[model samples]
Structures are given as C-alpha cells and as structure tokens.
Target: MRDLQLYASEAQRYPPESVRNHMISNSIVPIARQFNEDMDALRGLLPTQTPCPLPARMAFVRNKKSLEGIIQRLDHRKIAATNIIARYNNGFHLLYLLANLSRLDGFRLHCNILSAADGIKALSVSQDALSQTLSRRHDALEAELQGQKAEVVEGLQYQGSKTSLALASLESRVHSQQQSLDELSSRMSSAVASPDVLGRMVRAELRQQLEPLLHRFADVSLLIDQIALGVSKKASEHSDFKTGGSGAIHGLSNPGSERRVIYTWVTTYRVRGSQDGYFRFRFVFMPRSWLCSTGISLVFSSGPDEFGHYSICPSILPIQIIPYSSPVWDIFERDDAFAVRQLVEHGKLGLRALTEFGQNLLRHAVHDNLPNICRYLLRDSGYGTLFLDDADMSMEIPWSLIADRSVEDDIESTREILQLLRAYSDSGDDSGNQSEWGWNNIFCSPCLSFEQKKSYGHLFLEFGATLRLFSWIRNDDMELNKSLLNFYLDTGGDPNQFAKTGIPPLLFALLLLSRGDIEPDISLVTILISAGADIYYIHDPDNDPDTARTTTDWAFALEVEDLWEAALEECGLDIASVYAESDRRLQDHRRLRGATRSGVDVESITEPGPSSELRRRAGQAGRRCEEGWIAE
Candidate 1:
C-alpha cells in the first residue's frame, strides 16, 4: 500500500475524488479487519487479555485517522509503514503480526511494517540483537547440547559394567602390549630418526629375525641344479616349444620362472635439512618394437629424491645382464622378435614429444598462475588461443624461484594445472574463448598489474580485483563469480584485497546478501576462506599506550556485524543460522590454512575438485571476456 503511494507520488498523480474516497474507505477498514484477524489468530496462541491496551487504543484511533487521511490526500509521505506504526502505539505488535502472516503465507514483505503511513525500512531489527544472533552460533550450541545428553545417558548406563570392565581390561592388556608396542614403535621411529644405538638395535633385530630361514635352505649347487631343471620344465609348457626347447638357454629360462629382465638408472638431489631429494629415471614396459622405435617411457621427479627407485632382485629366474649405461642396446638385441615386428607394423613414430620439462620454466610455458593473463591473452589472441603474458611480473623467473625452496615446496603443480583448465579452457572445444577487448585493455584482464606503469600499483590492483570479485559474486554473476573464484585459487589472488580498499569480500558478500540481491556461493567463499577472509572474526589489535603501536582493528568486525544484522532483517532469515554458517566456514578455513602451514601431510589437505558448475561459469566468462561489455 505504501509502495502504491510512493508510486503515485513519483508519478505526480493523485487519484480522483471517487478513487480517493475508495482508498480512504479501504485504509480505515483494512486495519480494523487486520487487527480483528490477528486477534482471532492469537486468541488461542496467547493470553486472552493481550488486546489493545489503553495507550494502544488511543494510538490506534490516531493510526485509524492517519490511514484515512493518507487515502484522501493521496500522498506517499503520510502512508509509509513508519508513520502508521508511530500512530499506533502497538507498532511492534502490528509488525509481529504481519511478519507471522507473511511467514505463514510464504511471502516476503520487504517493508518494515505493513502499515498505511510513514516510509517503511526495507528491513528491521535492532542492530545489537542481530549481532548477538549472528555471533552466538546457536545451532552448534544445540548440537553440542544434544551430544552431551546422549553422552551422559551412555555414561550412566555403561558406568558400572562397560566402564569398569574397560578400565580394568585396559590396564592389564596395556601392560602386556606396551612393552612390545613401545619397543616396536621406537625401533621403527629410529629408521627416520638417528642412526646410532637405537638404529643398530632395530637393524640387528630385523636382520637376526630373518636370518634363521636362510640356514634351513638346501646346498647351493644342488639347489641351483634343481632350479635349472624347474626352469626347463616350465619353458616346455609352451606349445611352440619343442620337447627339449626349454634347454635352448638363449632366452635364459630359469628354475620355474617366466621373468623378463628390466634395468633402469635413477638419480637424486639433496634437500635442505634432509639427506634425500632427487630426480629419478625409469624404464617403463613397452613392446620390443616400441623399444627400437624410441617409444620409451621417461619419468622424472619434479622435486628431489622420491620413493621407489629401480632395483634388480631375482627370485627364481636366470637373469641376463647388459651394459648398465646402455639399456637401449639390450632392446636392440630383440630386433628380430615378434614384439619388435608389431611396433614396426603399427607406429613408425613410436614416442610422442617426450621432453622432461622439469624445473625448466621455458618448457612448461603455461603459467597457470595467470587467469588475468588469460583474460589479457584473450584480448589479443583469439579466445581460442590463450596467450601467455610476459608482462606478468609474478610469472618472470624470480631469483627466489630457485633460492626459495620452502615456498616452492608449498606450491602444488597439479593444482595449478587443474586451476588453468578450470579458468581458461573451454569445455566444448579445445580452443579458448575469443577476444573482445584489446590486448592491453586494463579491464579485460581481471588481475591488477604488477608493473608500475599501471594507474594503481600491484597491491591496489589486487585489492580492486578482490572487490570486483565480491561484487560479482554478490550480484550472482555466476560467470564473473566463477572466473573470480578461479582467479583467486589459480593466481593465489589477493588475500589482502581489502587491505587497501578498506572493504573485504566477506563484508561485501554479507551486504549483497542483506540487500536480497544474491545468495552465497560456497566455492568463492572457500577461496576467500583459504586466503584468511573471515566475516565473524576480525583481526583487530589494540594500540599500546606507551609505544602507540596498534595491535589490531575491530572496525571490520563492527561493519560485518552491522551488515549481517541488516541482511537478517532484509532477508527475514534466522540471524543465528546465517552466523553459524559463516563461523563454520571461517573457522574451518582458518584451521585448514593452519594445518597446511604446520607441515601437515599433503595427502591430508582436502582437494576441492573442479566444480562442473564453476567450469560452466568459466566457459561463460571466457565467452564474456571475448565479448567485452559492462557487467550490467
């Protein structure tokens, strides 16, 4: 009704006398009807005496008259929710009633109060209450309470029997097992620890434990003769073999063996504070023909000494030896073999381009760290061709690239590959998106320039990118959101984007959410989360009185609180629910980052796989980047 009045006012149109009279009638009559309907609904739900009090009665008369005047005047100012609420002393009651009705009807009433006077705020709720609700995390508390109840009940039931027997048995069994477990644990620990008394103790125990089996074996020469006989018997099983073909010996059949000889050479490098960190070489199995055609498998380690190097250990076969440096020569010896003939028949060009790019940046020219680069690249090169931007300062081979091993260790190359495919590559075709903006267009590249020639410095550019990302996400610009998300993960996009901008992604996300513009995207949220963006907890430090050193600032926290409450009021969502979700995400990411920093195993880090939806958005962004325009 207030919206109607506002529209009338904005349109500069007042209803005719007949229309005004009708509106006046409806305004006065509708409230009374609403009051009666509400009272009827709550009669059974609340105390019977909770009707309009004396003060409320007087205010209700004023409210009644104001509604009538609003229709007669056809003025927007007189018909907003606030004036009506103020006119009626029971404004909160009216609001509460309307809120209940709206919820029951499954409709949203963005107006502050369903009144016929005074401008209605889009949302309502005292700021403090909102903050408490967002911060309290009520759901977690409820779950905790429920868990406690279950645990307490279990404890009571198990106290006398389960608890007692478990305790009694634990100590008894622990005493027996402790000696062996502790010794074994220590002995195993010694292998990774120091090599002295403890190490010798472990080695002696392991070797002595296995040596007795060797003594039970038959005489060496007699056993060899028997093994040879077994090898010949096994070779004779092949239909192609003659009755005595097992004795051909050129193929070197051993005692009960069907073994093929393989030899590989591996090399390793050193790591800081560690003995092993090296690259390795392996001879992967290929057909004999492939071996002659240079179809050899070549594997190299990206880092230092890795696990599982080549070794020759014959169990029950006669082995042939070739020159260690020339494993290829050994394959050439089988040129006349059937496997070699098959390779010549099929693929003359046996091996695909085989170059161990290794730590060489040139060979691995794809700088997966540049989503902005792809954006920039698409500007010049067709979207079908994602060009690598040399201008990206971060991509330039840094002195620290080789010098900073610690930083390098933290980088996951596979993640980069995944991010690149996610951000730049089009799913439908192998080609990238087409170019729309120019090669040097600033806006085309989503990333801030690290080069000094750009208007904003590197840090500010990063900061702006963060803001744009938040804005896009908030607007539910899925394409932009996806690209920004990819940018964040792939480029390690600016964590401190808000550092200079004075506005973080969390706050923006909350603000947009409050405005009822968009819902949250957890993927983008996850990226910000990993980068230390938290809505609930702000890193505010206090200033020292003596030194005047500022420890932290809680301004962000206050802003978040204000925005959160406003959002709750706007969205009509449970304030506690939103807050709990925020805290859970924030705390989880903080813990995740902490774990990574504390040297937790790489395997432990949960990999967020490619979101198919995200890929779709990226594909769209790629197309959008090709067709440049203002993002609505």
Candidate 2:
C-alpha cells in the first residue's frame, strides 16, 4: 500500500502505467514466486496419507489438482497471484492455501518445513502490520516527532520570556552604572577652599560616590562565578554528544559559536506519505577516520575467512558500505533453541533467499559440534535433504565434513552427531527417493587422511552407513593402510553382506593393486581372505573369463594367481577343483548366452554342471551380482 503511494509520487518521472507495472513486477512478483516455492517445499514434506500419519515427513499434499492450479498460475512468466489480478479472487486462493498450512497440524513439521509454515504466517502478519503502519491514522513516528516538536516549541516560548527578563535587568544595571558615573564626574568638578582640604575632600568624595557601583561589581562577579560553577557541574554530569539510528548531531560547541563536527549525519524521510514516514537507510560517513589510500575500492580482510555477499546487486552497480542490521548468521551463534527454531520455522530456511548466510548453515552447526542443533536441522526441522548440494563438499552433506580431521577432537559430540545422522537415515523413506541413496555411498570416496579414515570410518559404517564404498580407480586415495581396513571390518563393514553388486572387496583391492597406485603387498590379499572375502565367490555365473573381462580377471592380469590360490587353500578350499569349476562355469556361461539369444528360457534349463560339494559351498558363500558386489 505504501509502495503504491511511493510510486504514485514518482508520476513526474514515470508514466502511471509504467509505475504500476514496475510495482507488480518488482514487489508483487517476487513475493508470489517465494510463496510458490514455499508451497512446493511444503508439498514435498506433506505426507501421502490424508490424516498425516507422520509430521516428520514435512507436509502432506492435501490436493494435487489445487496445487497444480497454483503452480500453473505461478510458473515462470504466467504470474497471477497479486492484490488486483483476477477480480480479487486470486488473493483468496492464495490466502486459503496459506491457511491450509497453518492451524492444521498436518501443515507443520518438526523439521525445516516448520520454518516454511512460520514464514507463511509471518508474510500474512507482516502485510497486515505494514498496512496499519502506512495508514493515515497510524503514523507512530510522525506523531512522536510532532509531540517532541510541541515540547520544544513550548520550551522556546519560556526561553523567550526569560531572555526578556534578563535584558530588562541588564538595562536597569546600565542605568544605575550611568548614574554613578554622573555623580563621580560631578564630585571631581566640586571646588575645595585650602590645598590640604582639597586633597582630603576629593578622596572622601570619590569613596562616597563609588561605594554603590563597587558593591554592584562585587554582586556581578558572584553571579558570574555561580553560573560558571553550574555549567561545569552540568558538563560533568551529562554527555554532550548523542547517537542513535534516527540520527544524532554532535559538535564541539553550542549554537552561535565556532563548531567542529564530532560526527555528521543526514536523514531522508518519506516525502509522499500522509504522515512523514521513517523508512530510511542511514549512511554515516567515516571518510577520513576509517578509509585509507585504497579503502574506497579494495577491502582488507583481517579474519580467517568471510561469508560472501549474498545480494542480487550486480558487480556493475556501485555499492556503498553502509550500516547493516545484525545478520541471521550472528543470530545462529546465540545458542538459543527458541531463536534457532524461530528462524527455521518462519520459512527463513526455505522462503528467504537474499538473507541466506553466505555459508551452508548446517555445515556451520556441525563444525561447531552442536549435535542438538544438528538433530533439529537434520530430522526435527523440515530442512530438506542433505545430499542435493553435491557441488560443494563443505556446504552440503557432512560426508566430507565428518571426514574433516582439522576440527577439534570431541569424540562425545562427534558420536552424538553420528547418532543423529543414523536416525535421519532411518526416518527417511528411501523407497523411491533415489537421492536418499547418497547416504549409503559414505566410504566410496576415500578423501580423508588415514587417521581420519580410521577414526570415523568404522563409526559411520556401524551407525547405519552401508559398505557401498566404490570410488573410481583414478580418484582412489592410495595412502589408505591395512589398519583402516581392519578397523572398518571390526566395526561393521562386511564385504560379504547383502548387496545388489557383490563385487568382492578382495577383487576390488586387487584391481587397485594392478593399477600400480599403491605398492603391491601379498598381505593386502591375505587381509581380505582373513576378513572373509570369498576368493571363490563369483557374483554372476555369466561373468565368464573369456567373454566378459571382470575383476576376477585382475588376479591373472596382475600375476597374483599364486596369492589367489593360497587364499583359496587357506579358506579350506581346493585350488585344483576351484579352477576346474571356474572353467566349467565359463563354458556354461557361453551356452546360456547363446541359448538366450535363440529365445530359450535359460533359467528353466540351467543345471548344476559339477556334483562337487565344494562348488556348492562357494556358490552359497556368494551369489548376487549385477554390478559386481559379492555377498554371502
């Protein structure tokens, strides 16, 4: 409402149609887009069940058709949500949709979604509050200013009366002093009979004539002394220079004297409103005080790092350094759960874009070792998925953050964070959400130090993280040692565990060894065999030695056939029989491949080629493999 008037006042510069268009495009359009985004986030959190069986999910979609209608109305260029767009019906629809999110328990979530809810409510409340503030009858700042001005006027009137009295007294004292001067002049001219009599007579006349004026001078000196004493007391008791957001003017002297500026200030008020409004930006100049030779252009950093400016303002646009309000990031450091929830729940996490802390807020909390806050963000607050922002390792999920060894070692706090992450993993419904599978890919990228890997690797795996650790061969960190692998096994990582790709770690490690990234060690092969890696476990019967070059080929490729045989022998399996069985398996694979191409049901005709009991045990130890992970 205030913006409409503000733009209306710009009539001399912009056309009426252009002004309205600018308001709609600049103010209303952005607000509507944010509202739509908040809606989408709420929809994502909304449960499928109508009754909202779980608030933890964020929000349940109450009506898909209505949601689509709103989306279609709002998508990209076809915006309709505004004050005067469609016979005023558009606003009703928006309000109703917002209401659906509030009051109803289904609209609220314990997580970041609540921020969306609070944000929606704040939107409504802020609109109403702003309207009231802009109304003609409700000019709080102007009214207060007017009231102060009235007191100042009254004080000035009283000051005028006191001035009049002081001037009158000054006139009376001047007349008295003039009368004494006349009497002294008269005494000096008076005649004396004898020489002795003349001297005595003149001195006696001077004393008699000057007594009243001398007493007046004494009284005047006492008054000046008293005034000086009072002024000194007042100066000591009170500060002369005052500063505030409104504005403060300070100088070296009072009015009508030479003034040196202690500080300089200027304010701009709403020149078009019914009552003068105080919506302003204060620009306090510190030109010579703070600016250096190059300070006007370049900024110097004294801190370790700085969060970037998350503004829409372009680099082409000139920006001035002005006083800004306390940032939300600073507020996050307050450690108040209520304040944190207030920020997250009020849609700040979802709706606000420009106000986003230049860093990943969740990462900040984790770095500070605030597990309780982590719990709120990860699970309770509807803060959305951790894995989506994969571009920045520092800003996204704690996969790399947990691997950061530079952070102070507080195992107890770290353990709590692990527990929170585990709970977050379990509560998440990963049935169709493919992004949720990012949780399972913990150990895949071995980017952390060997010590870091040993410290948190086991805990991550044990606390619900699966051992789907598979990084590309070139990116593999070859520095990983035997102790770390042993730690992973001791904690919970079972290479023989249930998985789709039963690519045995034994073969995976041998492939790494063959790449010559790490120094070859027979113990690397021995360690896997000791940890229950099935050298005889073939994931797929079709993984033939000749037809498909698989990890199984790596043993022969690296000339580790001796180590492979020894491992089989140690696992109480016959090397001769295993090789013979592998040969038979290769032949059967070819037969099956040919039969399948000719439209035969290979599964129906598939049979056990060898009757050996040892082969059956190897098959039992490992079976599932499509992408080559072996599991018992």
| Clash totals, every prediction | 26, 26
lDDT tens digits, residues 166-283, model 2?
9788657665553343211111223323434443443454333333344544553333343334333333332332211100111111121232212222223333345644321212
User: Candidate 1's residue-wise lDDT over 1-632, tens digit each?
Assistant: 34333433433345455333222222433453444444344322222233333343334435554444433332232244335544555345544544454354322111212321221121123345667786787877988999999999988987878878986775555334423332111112112233344334533433333232224333322333443343344332333321111121212112112223233535444565878565444443322221232233344444522244443432122111212244332333332233433442475312121212211111122332322322223332343121221111112212111111211121233233334433543222211111111112222333432231132212222222221222432235545555545554343333334522355565445444333445444344444433433324332123222221110122233334454454334433454554454444334445554332235545322222122111112333333323431111
The ten-residue window of minimal lDDT in model 1 covers 430-439
In model 1, the Cα lDDT at residue 23 comes to 27
TM-score against native, each model: 0.16, 0.34
Off by over 4 Å in 2: 1-360, 363-369, 372-409, 418-463, 470-480, 497-502, 537-546, 549-552, 562-574, 594-632
Global lDDT scores for all candidate models: 0.34, 0.44
What is the lDDT for 237 in model 2? 31
